[model samples]
Target: MDYGIMFQEENESMKERFDLSMERIGQIISEETVPQPFRDYFVRTASFIRMMGEYLRFIESGDQKKASIEVLKEWNRKLYEDILPGHKAALGGYEKSYADPAYAAARLGEGYGRLFSYLYKEIRGDIVFVHENRMKDITILNETFIEIYNMFEDEIPEVSTVKEVLYWFVSDYTDHTVSYRVREGLDPSLSFAVDIIKNYDLNDLKYLYYFGEYISDSELKTASFLNSLPEETVRLMANTYTEGYCRGFEVMGRDLKKKGMVQIRYELGFERMVKYAIENFEALGLKIILCRAAVWTVNTNAGRKAGYYSTSPNRQYEYDHRYDEAIYLNKAFKDRKAAVLKVAYEEYKELAAAYAGPAVMETFGKEGFKPVNKPEANRLDLKQEKLAVEMSNESSRILKQYVPGDETSFTIIAFPVPEIGEDFEKIFEETIAINTLDYEKYKGIQQSIIDALDEASHVEIRGKGENRTRLTVALHPIGNRDRETNFENCVADVNIPLGEVFTSPRLTGTQGTLSVSTVYIGEFQFKNLIMTFENGMIKDYGCDNFENPEEGKALVKQMILKNHDTLPMGEFAIGTNTTAYAMAQRFGILDKLPILIVEKMGPHFAVGDTCYSWAEDSPVYNPDGKEIIARDNEVSVLRKEDVSKAYFSCHTDITIPYAELDSIETIRPDGSRVSIIEDGKFVLKGTEELNLPLSGV
Candidate 1:
């Protein structure tokens, strides 16, 4: 009856029994742990099983409900604070460990890895075998165990049972597990930091131990840096993020008061800022949801993006496993995940719809992650790619079914962490100042440029210096000056630290070459990256990130284009964040700036869905009521005929730095071209203020 607290009830005796079992497992590992290289693995596997029990306790012991937050924090501290650092160190040794196939087999053979992996995958997969009970879903959890148990016994089961278990797991839990595993998806009260910060002293290093996230110099340095900055700086950072979130509701014309939760996704270093944002959201009647980076299955590393997470221990390992699902993914799994997602959404429909959206803080600049190309590390086969595309499209549809596009609005803001370089602090301050720039003045000035661009049928942009990029983007027609505008007058709120004028370019006439010298899209870097566009879709692409040209193309497909054969040029924008660009140049860390900041450094284009891909029907006003008619182009409007084909689910901004640009000219229907920026400086009369930083620096 109390199955909800099944693992929670592990008493001292039960824990002792687990310990003994682990000891025996460990002894077996030390003896038979073949290859000998995996000695350390068998060692850690034992610890993992033991530690998970601690987590199991706080999760189920409704008794610790009062101190549960602190308990959970302590449990996490054990994971991140205590274990992760050493785990990172041990990983270096693992390369040598795995070299010995015998040891690798022995270590993996310990069966404990399979056990926890099974438990994690199964329980999280949303098995509600005990569905009539109020505690939690047990049916779904046991199916995973049964699979692992079957595997553990080395006994093959009937094909139908395996299929049934997987179907229910994927179909019932993709959204639920995805939303649960990461805060951005749903489950608001899970902010890992909120519990830690509330229960421990911010000034105490001991406090870091409770979070269960990896603790390292980077995390500690980040926390120390923000704590040392004037409280005003921290408040400014929080205000920029929170105000933008509130403004998202305001801009979308959605009622903020009705939304009960706000999802906060960030790397571990910014807990101080997150702490403030959590409080700020609370004041707005919104609760905080904080989930971890995907670990179990179903939703692990997809690409450059990870939801709420700490710095990665090994980015290359992640890169290798990004497509690990290819091993078992099939039509049945896809249908199952979709089905689980539907069932889970129905089960948590109220929570799903109530989720306001995510307030994201993305980080950049960690030794410019150059991933090694691993050929043997499983990849998604061609068949899997099609199925994956269909699955994701269907998953998105099913998710939207519960949390309709019209009801939710989200915002993203990014900042660089200390890992950027020696000048991390200076870069951070400059970034902060740039985020809080005077939006009122820019708004008026942006309106003038927007008015001029509104009259253009097409815009021509040419690259200067070594930059070979030359492109043309077509604009939508506006019969009335009062009703439509070519570009959205982006100010500070919603997209905090704002600095861009963006529009959904007309796909029919938009054609030319869009290229950048070097840019970071998610995790991978593109060198001498070039994409040719005809009728707005990427016609051809090539980059020089890897020595092998085929590898280079594959990297682009995997990281940038996301395996899609082609993507339409969804957005064209002019970034007015010159001040921020100046700071980056001043600090000599231009490559270190995150896209959130870099996208505002120059005119950038996004090749995928437009900014309002899903919420196009939701009216969006840019302070002034001029309806933004540039919401849909040829590609996205395909939703009317086939929803799956309409959205590409990717929006990557590639910026051409101000110094690299030759000029931007708005071409009118009368054959006259008017210059908005000439020779890398704002020439539009009203936008001269944008050049202040240029002269000052």
Candidate 2:
């Protein structure tokens, strides 16, 4: 289907207004009406607005579909060249790149510099807007730029004037932006991304540019490598991914027949695998929903991408603007956003109800990015921080109202990107083997470990040499041991290449310090990370990422805690994937692995909501015909009374590698202990095979 035509009538309706915004923007490129440093900002920004208008016209003419590869490559670079690093000058050589918030703050006064740079970054969303034929969105942004520029026409207006313009722009447009985003995730008809994936020729790499995401060397080489793989190899990748997803519904007891749609979240350059996975899901009666990752400032989630995207052109640029919402966040705007979300879900209630949760394909092995926290960037104040938390709570509630968590299930798997090193191909193959491990064999082995754990009242974990981790986790009491198991016998379902059995621990007696010498969580690496838990909630935490201890604390708080003052110890699991640990050790890429695989390589603890966060009441059973009963802890139990206090809406797993381990033992109610793993090797009777992978280390 030609989905572009869906926007044709609307484009025509808004043509006159769009043309006027373009005409005014075109004049500002050369106009001397605005002042010195600020004049450069407006003039350069106006030039970018004109470029977007050209892109919109090109797409509207339908010429993009037939463009040659060379032309397509040139356009893709041109669209993002302003933000790409190492450029001599950005936006026409007038000054250093304003797209760099730090540079902009350096040139302009800190306040105005941050605000203008943020505005310019937001205006850049026009790239995606044009690709999707969002004429009204493009027109509104163009007008916003003109309005801000008009302020400077009168010899530097008060900062309040500029702030007011941005404040209302976010306020007034939240309805359109948030509503469209919610619908984009549910309604498959909004198929700007799906159309390109389904219709484009896989052998031609030119299709990468049509998505409008930044295409780096990593993405290009990744696509080339996949194209060279055998068809059977590709099918194996697709089968592992799709079957894990289907198995999520089956294992979790969610009815697959009730869901009509599945949202595919993946990186660019995995189209061959994603396309095959689409066919696999279609065979299972699922329509694919592929939405572009959020571009608008209001929709972007703290520099994290949710939908489909490519490698970031500038990680620092994204990091600096993560809190752009601080420019206009208030209780009124927060309440307005919540109300808009409810209305949007109301309109798409049917589609939302039919939605299965995300099937995520994560890529690892990029050079680690430790961002320089710039003082000039926007930071939320105390009141704003609390308001932000409230907004998250309300939004989560609204989402569950439409897409009930109990009815939806998700699966996640990871692969290595080409950026790892010279051993990229070897690492990729090894990753595949790790993902497709013998599921039946591991199932039986993991069940043995689960049986031992079911007899414990709590688990004792202590760190080996130089890794001072002393943690005691309280497990839920199994009511009727014959029919109950505390831990799920997890293996390659929902979480692929799975090798761990986990549970939500009772928080009353869960206490002690958890520490890791070096660990990567998301894009940031924490050095000498340590956290003190008192009664299952975070009492204190610190890291050595920054010279100043307080700065390191702030990083942990923002990224891991999601701005909550404290979070509960939601899950505890002993990883059984010795093969994966050995692979990382052989490649010496331990820090480059993603959490999806790393969490299965050692004993890891997760803080926030448990594995059964919103679905605690749902029954989950193991392969042994026993019900897994440890779904709720002290925090999650509050869902029956008050939901806002029940969930933190975040789950971050911090793993301690085998080399850093001492021992893990299960404590019985009679003051006896059963040893599970000691000195980084499995000592249990049935789990000795897990030690074979570490033999040659």
Candidate 3:
């Protein structure tokens, strides 16, 4: 019976219902039915909703009469001003309003206040969508809030009763939210990004405001900087990025022609580069999908942003709300989400089938964030934690069904943001140089390192001066030593600025203590980080990030271990990019470099999934035409019987900087040892060329 027509009719009915619900809410806000403080809160919230509704209509009507540069700037500022640092501290605003959970619990009931805060935060995230004329989402959330408000009008329900209603709201709407998110990831037809990039005059800074992302000074300066660069420079940057992505497919032996679309994820300010990249990908017969990072908590995983985004207005606010799913997550909710995700993928099976993979442009050099642990933040219990992991596994399985992992390949490259320092331009130029280093030279140098590694039964690494790292990494045995190699001779392909030969090590004999004096991972800085491995899996881990030792351990668990009690050491490699290391040391920006580049600056170890991940069976070969055999380790081999237990879906690389290295040696079965590096300098006979960059340091 024409499901599309039926769905349209249902959508119309919902819109009508939403209007009536909001009208009733507005009336309720006028009447002082609830107590004084609660009434004040309702009035203020309802006023904001009314303003949003008006703004939604204004934009939907194509009212470009007021979309001039100055007007748009004011509009963007007004929209985001409340959450900006100074304004967020103002009295009775959104931030200060929900600042204290205990105070809220006292004013409202314990459960009611928590639920209300969650509702407000969720609604706040939808403001951008509302302005974009995507009202279906905001309508549903508003309708739900109205339903709960109606229940309070006549009588305030018990705390359990209120909590149950909130839970059911999330449970019932899971299908809608989950499906929309999955579709956004797959379907390029929803071209919010394409329209902006193609239709707007990019030279006019006003276009940046149309995205509804919080535009910071970094974004402004970045856009201006790109505008100031010659067209050739922009094209060069784009060419390198797109070429790296194409090479990834070639290297992995995947047919790029079979795929019709590619996902483009980057920070907002780099539109010039992204625009050129779009043209480049189109030249390769690929359409681009530019989705935004997840706005709703249900759609977010492990608090990492994906897709195109701007610099966050408040990292602490994001951290404070990362685990909001704890309010409603359960086995039932998990099952419901899994079922909905399956349906969503099935609906978009055709698009998913043609999906290539992500081409990501990561940015770094933001201010280091040290999050203050707030008691008000949600924390997942043991059962919920287990459910979260299972849910991730199940979702991945569903995605793999349509978009086969072996068929898709991805490339990641990073650039520095303006926040890096006064030397931002110098560093930016150096980064481009680093990214476009002579691949032929690196190919030859890395092959030498890999050749020496192929003869080793295991490799030992030890740290120098105040750094106490010591470890043994077991290499895969070569049955036909004349033709096979354990490590891949990696250069600038999937991983740009790449200068490393890496392998999935045999886990049985890999054991050690890995320590770093200081490092910045993701958005947080770690001090005196240490991890102990027994048979390759993390046996113990800790850092001195927080004053309390237990808090520090918790940070390690959440960030590196990724909530797993233990994860296997999946990868070990020797970084051959001493040039990058020297540049960072010269500029004093080592701590600000992203892992995409930093991982190649020294000997590094990865925990959790191997670099191969779901593509263990995919044949990969080096330049010399030898298949890399070390794709799967002890844990990944479990995929034959139980796929869920086979993958942890997280890989965190912890690197030992060259300054900390004492020595790295390859030990053969006959007890003969060949040294690759000693006292942080390349001492291997054939690889001495790498030391030229570090000469006289």
Candidate 4:
């Protein structure tokens, strides 16, 4: 079933529109009516568009796959060179790329800078459209360019006129863009990426160029490294990853057979492991939906990617464009987007219902990225910010209505990329061991911690040395100590290589400050990250990421609090994977580990939503038959009344390394204390075995 053929009539209609737009765009390159600096900008962009026209022809004629590796590399570079760091018109110190908001502000005046810059980025989506053979998408984008260029044909057009064109472009095209994104996530038949991964000669490495993403040494080396490994080793990697997904279903008591499809998200370099993973998933009667990450501004999120992708050529480029929606976002547009989203999901209700959620393969080890807060970038204003929050809440509700989060589960496993310095191979091997650790062993040790916690009212965590974390997390009262538990004895299931016992804390009494010397969450790094909490919700938070204190606080609020003024302390857990801690210490790559591995190395606290955000009603239990009952807190409890206020739609796990810990103790109702960890080593009687790995470090 080639889904592309279904749109043949639509594509035929779009061909005339595409050709007319291209002809008009070609005329803009020679036109003299537009003004000076802005005229050159349009001319350059028109040239790029014409270049993509040629590339599209090459791809449509089937020459791309038959071309040599060097030819493919040349095409890929030509498409992306204008924005790559050191290129003639790329972003950075002196390069004034049209894609850079700052550069746009400098070259054009501030009034029309960001608008044109975003337009350039929007046009860049042609690379994706051309590869996917989405002629309608390419045609509409060219039409948008021509529409804007027409304004310049006359005397200097009003900024309002230029903005009106962009605003309507986004508003009118919401149905097409948003619908395709939804369909891509749910429909396994939309198999652009699946065909390449399953049928291409992965050993040749030229298959890497087929995706049209920027290929870096990191991607090339990762593919080469995996290819060099034994077939058995590759199978072990795939088995560990796929088995983790199955184990998630087994542990949660969810029937995997009920689901028909699983979304496999990963970096571009792991096709070999992903190939085996595809077979393993298919054997379990699950179709694989391999969607590419969002290329359209409407579908992309800030500094986070959800589908298959490659190493970013420039993190700052993405960071600057994080809030590109501010140009046209209003209450009406927000409402329009919400309506389109609901309809899109309704159209694919069956596929959404059968969705098993994402099986994510993550990679870490890149140098920690510290984003610069550029003054010229577009930002959501106060009213727009409020609207953005409202849209987020509405969108979550709409999604849950179709694909209930409680009905599905996810598994995330991360490995190292080549960017983690000299110990890449050694660290990779250690990561495999960490991922496939003795699940039964950690389940027993974590159960002991849970037993102690279940008897307590709250837990006190104190950070030693430079880490200034002093927080008290109130636990849920267990009704029957014999059959109920506050903390869940987690193993390598949903969270791979897991070693934590966690519970949703009671927000009424939970309060204090959580501070870390340095941490990496998502694509940004925080320096001396600190948050003050009152009643388990963020009261005040600040970081040293920027020179100005306000800027630092804004960064924390944007990234951690997720635009919400305050977020509840959703989870409290003790990480017992000292072996993972030792490995990070030994390799001197503490900052390079992903949260999936880092969360297991120490006691971590999560904010926003609990581990069981939308699935609070789903029964979960520890290994010893005791039901883990603390799934929801005060915020989540509001779901019974107002679903809009129930969840924050985000969860960020911040871990405190064992080396930074002073002690963690549980306080009983009678004011008695039981020390679980003292001076960074487990002091509990039955959990002493976890400390063996700490001794080696």
Model 1, poorest ten-residue lDDT window? Answer: 126-135
Give the Cα lDDT of each candidate. 0.69, 0.89, 0.83, 0.88
Quote each prediction's TM-score.
0.84, 0.98, 0.96, 0.98
Error of 2 at 313 (Å): 0.4
How well is each residue in 392-447 modelled by candidate 3, as lDDT tens digits?
88888888888888999888998999999999999888888888999998898888
Separate clash counts for every candidate: 31, 0, 0, 0
lDDT of 4 at 481: 99
> Which stretches of model 4 miss by more than 4 angstroms?
3-6, 87-94
> Candidate 2, overall lDDT?
0.89
lDDT of 2 by residue, 1-697 (tens): 5787878898899999999999999999889987788888888788888888788777768788779878887788788887776652244421267877778888788888888988988888888888878888989888898888887786687777788899999999999999999999999888888888889897898888888887888888999999999999999999999999989899998899999999999999999999999999999999999998888888877736899988888777788888999999999999999999999999999999999989999999998788888888898998888898889889989999999899999999999999999999999999999999998999999988998998899999999999999999998888898999999888998998879988888999999999998887877878899999999999999999889999999999898888889999999998999999999999999999988999999999999999998888989999888998889988889888999889887889999999999999999999899999999999987999999999976
After TM-score superposition, the amount by which residue 258's alpha carbon in candidate 1 deviates from its true location, in angstroms, is 1.7
- Regions of model 2 farther than 4 Å from truth: 87-95
Task: Report the lDDT of model 2 for residue 265.
Answer: 96
Ranking by lDDT: 2, 4, 3, 1
